[model samples]
Target: MITAVVGMAMAASGCSAPGPDPGGATATSPEPGKSISNAGETASWELLNAAEITPESTVLRLGVTRIECASGITGTVLEPEIQCDGEQIVIRTSVETPEPGDYSCPGNNMVPITVHLQSPVGQRQLFDAACLDAETLATAFCVDGGVRWRP
Candidate 1:
């Protein structure tokens, strides 16, 4: 009887031993400045700042927040000129305006314009416009054929 009881206790204790880890060693977090990669993953871009456009110039602030490219590249900020291959963004330094006598609208009547940004994921509008007027200051940014606007 004693031997049987001892055997049962040993069996019960063995059942309580730790099992295999579900996450495994690969689940551990990477060290600082290091990264992990998996196959067939895609990269993503993140806009850091709202785009700002003026009568004389247009500006966009953007950065890459996630990357899973074939080249093993990481997320980064793209140069202003190289953004989206120039297809999605357009900037003009000088704007042509009508002559003083061409329109009755006052020069001080500056209309605020808001631009929208489009991407593979979704659409987002630029920063809120200071002012907006449809006739003269109507400008928009169409990316990937999508429109972006907050309100």
Candidate 2:
């Protein structure tokens, strides 16, 4: 009786956000690009290179790439495939554009891939492999903020 009651209470007390549901629907990643909102004009802009901004500087930008793979046999598991060189990685970026103003990076239209980092175990990760696996390269792109899986 007490066990049953406790079980019911425990189940009721648990309130947690659900994980990604693979069978249900796959959430698509956002596209990379510049979003400009000035006056009544809303324009979508692409990332610019640092050299483009010789005397003019615009937005704050960052890029990150992460590698992910499918794990287990569930067919829904995406795991990090260890590359011959190392772990899987993806490059992404983040640009700082002030609201109500036009912003762009200085130097060139395309941001350089300078800083590279890896992800932790049991989580998504990224690496700097001179050449990525065929599967990874298929969905890689340099978008608004950084490189991401767009395949």
TM-scores of the candidates in the order shown:
0.20, 0.20
Model 2 lDDT tens row, 1-151 = 0000001111121111122322455433323231211122111112223333221222212222222221211111111112211121232223332245343323223222222112121122222221222332343332222321111
In candidate 1, the residue pairs with backbone N, CA or C atoms under 3 Å apart (3 or more residues apart, or in different chains) clash, namely 112-131, 112-132
Q: 19-82 in candidate 1: lDDT tens per residue? A: 2222342222112222222222222222333343332222233332212111222322222111
Poorly placed runs, candidate 2 (over 4 Å): 1-87, 102-108, 118-151
Worst 10 residues of 2 by lDDT: 1-10
C-alpha lDDT of candidate 1 relative to the true structure: 0.22
> Candidate 1 versus the native: TM-score?
0.20
